[model samples]
Target: MLKKEEVKKVVRPEAPQYVKDVVEHPPFRVTTNTTLETLASYLRKFPIDVVPVFKSIFSEDVAGVVYPHTSLLIKSKKLDAKIGDFLNPPIVVKESWKIENVAEILIAESKWGAVVVDEEGKYVGIVTLRGLLSALALKEPKAKSVAAIYTPLGEKKSRAGFVKAIERVSKIFKKLVGGEVDGYVVLSRENGAVGILTIWDFVKSRRWYRGAGEPRPLFGTRVTRGESKHTGVVRVWRIMFRGVAVATPETPVEEVAKYMATTGLYVVPVVDKDQRVIGAVTVWDILHAYLYGPKEGREDIEVRKAIEIVVEKPTLETAIGIRPSKHVTGLRARDVMLTDIPSVNIRDTLSRIRKVFLRSRSSIVAVLDDGGKIVGFITRRDFLTYIAEKSLGYWKRQKGKMLILKEQVAPGETVRILVEEGTAGDIMKTNYPVVAPNTTVEEIAYKMLAAGTDYVVIVGEDNTPIGVVTKDELIKAFKERGRKAKVGELMTPAEIATVNFFASLHSVIKKINAYELDGVVVTEGNDIKGVVSVDDLALRPIEETLRGEKIIFFTKSGVLRKVSTGLRRLRYSKVGTLMAFDVMRPVSLNISINNDVGEIIDKLLENGVLPVFDEQGRLVGVLNKMDIVKDLARVYITYAMPEKVAEVKEMEREIKQS
Candidate 1:
């Protein structure tokens, strides 16, 4: 076992320095008297997200601000209106304030920009969220592995589950006190791909709900009939955006940080060579690294020991058979291919297609035929570009008449009208990038860059979409495999927690909660088949439950039952119709018990959990990232044993005498 002192003595290379000593962009001043046309022109000319609006140009004090959305509202209302009408109070931060604190305030307010003031209360500059991210990117954490910080998909998938998961993650994020993660990643059991569900996507979905005349406690108003109304159930699968950027263990922190800054991503999943999600890297993680460096010490031995005891002896791992691997090899695309890739039926609606795009969080998604064969594809930019161009063209053609029409149109109706302007077929591409399962990481990267896209479909011999690999996945996979240390010393030794494939979903949920586990292994007798968790439940929603319709079903004993009005019974209805086998995620990867410790840590950091197997290929134990952390902190070992300390002192004295 590696000693704490030895581990601490291993000096990490210093991160890239932050060169800029001051905020890059100074706050451009605008006045309340500034015309909407002038503000719009300024926005078009400048690469800024916001500008300070003051009572007068001569006044040094900022009155409020004008942003993109505010500009839109101004244009939609009165083009001649003054900027003051739409001004919102600015979130001002002192120049000396920690960037992390600034980030927290901005995130909470959903504001894109904050005014950085000097000690004398003079406006010095503006700090947009992206700017802070960019600045942080300059001094990112020393890259050890992406898995060290990536948040797991955990046991979350339903709307309620999503809400709870977000809340839970938010709480964890708050504790970071340096930066925040803005979204959650879901490894969809339904689709068999690692996907993203962002807070902004949720915000958009909330708007859709409000547009459908549903009462949302969070967003209190309803849209009028002229706008599109999305009345379907809001499932995680329907609204999640697809595709994610990923990083490997060896990838530099600067690379991940720069990507997040440029792309506005808050988190990036870390994957091994095989493309399995082992862990994730987030802005907060980077911030922590930036502020505190890698944490190690003999200083909080009690706290470390307490954590080790609690996490090392987890009841969930004890119930589930999981273990660590002995060796990690360079993996091919086949290792990460998602067998249950999501595809839209040819007959599906634009609404349905839109939902799929949101669910995948991918700019591009597969379109299928009636026979479930691949046909074409749809992309985010295609529809979005079409909408903006069409809207502008229509407004320009109408000229004066359009301005009148806009004045007459209700505020809620705007989005609906815009949505009605296009359909799935309008923006879908028939020819998209595709790759085979055996493709290497280098080849995949070359293909993606050559095709000028971040995502590609993985196909089997039959030319059907088996899975997908994104730009992020390729970037992360580039990190080479690691070695040193053994799995037995690193992995958590536990009996696998599992449920039969035929078990009810409710039973699965109950079991997971009872055991306080993220997921449970699905088994057929003594053989492990797959895994099931809360995310599966969140992704799979029963139609009857959403519609609140009466569902009559027969029990296995031939008994008849009717479920009406209540969601629990409705969920139970789904359970009666489908088994755990219906929602279980296929097990594609596991580590050997004799694998190198470095390989085990890499796996745990990136994958969240490691399924340990014995030499005979039998499942043995499971090791989670937390378990590794505890072990690293020397929580399980007695601190500063008296005999060992005395022996160390004697040895030191002998050396000194010599």
Candidate 2:
């Protein structure tokens, strides 16, 4: 018979872990030119504590780093400025460095983590405090439960007043030395953990109060203050994240650390079987354990070969010869098509079509014939074009070309009435792209790009619509494949269209129409000031017209008057005068042409388009949703089904021949 300790050791074997085992790809990296607003948007989406900044995409030189807390501290107006203007020098370490040494450096520097580089001095990945904790937890399986490491929320602290209690909790988080904690949980007598709050919530609330047009606060409570008052009290219940995840006291420390590492959530509240709050486990506590806990049997492993860091998990699988399921080569249009279509009769009034667009929340509305067969389609762009033309016509009919009117020339209601009089067929695009239900998703994607559209309608045997495939569906498919292709391989190479910052709105509209572009970059000399898109120019006016708001015009008499006229006042306005700096998303939202396409798919889906730059920071091409869809289709045909390559080529030839 073996002794108990000897038997336990035989049952579970221990292996040494290294920093390379725990390092992961950073969520996203930004260039020094990235703006605070764009950084904030990325932080809001991923909730990562630190963001790495590179000198340029072409090199591995570290510029600096941006913290979420630092981003929140800047005024909203200054968000348009470049991040390089306000950054902390980055702390870098070798990939082979010991985890314990890295932890000491992070604590001593009072930083989140250091950027990891390969022996060749090239960027590889990041090793965070959270990652170290996770490695430690895995190395010590027999370690104590979460209760041993959690910070107890005593009865008195749990029952304290909302604001006062939060202040105290914030102080406790501030005193931690190793890892940073930005999240806190609220406990109530009835509910074990009522809600969770992070530093993000407070910053978001500030933006809302400053009228930056941020989304309403998550907490349903509103803050009211006098004109002279600088502060307002807010109830804790209104601002906390009510659906926060919790861990039981008896849960394994490794389990909690694994959850934090996977989700980027650094804090978890501990509860008892009765659902009463006991304590909380944070990233700092996990770090403390790894730094001071038992290391009796643990050892560090040596890394011989350099490991290639992949930012996406699925990409790593692809690197190892495991193709994702969506790229199985048998997916057809029917497999990924959206069956619930929004449609209207060809003869339906424009008013009816508008209502359908608003209700369905769709960008495209199918136009059907009398027999319920698809004939054409109406897009939001079409409506915008109609309004712009009508407004221009009404302006042209008036005698004054540049005169500021003192009174109403035509009631704003006239444009609205005229717009509603046309039928869907009057503005519907007849050259809409169509596809067969059995067509491969790749082929569908190709047709969309060749036709210069974002979607393709799937037809049945009789040429009637069965379903539709859009860029969104293709994005999902591409995300699953986890291809390692670079953005330069898929982006549409074109000279960037630009307009002077001082140009009039009339010139801006002309440039857009002439180039058939959705937007143009605004520049001063060679520097990019901002971007003005179709949404800013056309959609905004249409929304104002629909809302029955009076258009303000300043007459030569120097008095501002509310006129019920058409869009004549806006036609001659300077772009700089009317354009909102915040509307300039491209100021900081660009990607390197050499970056992996998988890293920017989400950004393309969100912005509809992105500006691609070379190593020299010069705009080389534009990568839009259509470009990605086309590439996905091409990849699918090339790898998944090689036999279809010739067929796709012939289709391309036919499209070009026509």
lDDT value for model 2: 0.56
Segments in model 1 whose C-alpha atoms lie over 4 Å from true places = 1-60, 63-113, 118-120, 140-143, 152-181, 190-194, 199-210, 213-232, 237-239, 272-279, 295-658
Q: Please, what's the RMSD in Å of model 2?
A: 26.3
Q: Candidate 2, clashing residue pairs?
A: 219-238
**lDDT for every model?**
0.47, 0.56
* Per-residue C-alpha lDDT of model 1 across residues 169-247, encoded as one tens digit per residue: 3233221212123455555333232445544333233233233344334355555445434443344545555433445
Question: What lDDT is reached at residue 580 by model 2?
Answer: 28
Q: Highest TM-score among the candidates is held by which one? A: 2
Residue 401 of model 2: what lDDT? 15
Question: Candidate 2: which stretches are off by over 4 Å?
Answer: 1-330, 345-359, 368-375, 393-421, 497-499, 502-518, 534-538, 542-590, 614-618, 632-658
lDDT tens digits by residue: candidate 2, 1-658:
9998888767853322555655667566788888777777666545544667889977667788777666553453465778888778878888887777887787667666777887887877776665665555456543345655666675332211222223443343232211244466676655466655566554444443243343343357554443323333445555554434556655556656654553445657776666666767776556655666423443222211111212222221111122222443457888888888699998886556656765676767888889987788877667656644544321111111111111111100011122224677887888868888888777777567556565788888988777888777887777766366788876655443565555544455555544435566666666776666554442232110101111221111111112431222221111012222222333558689898888888877655556778899987766655555655556554666655556645666798999
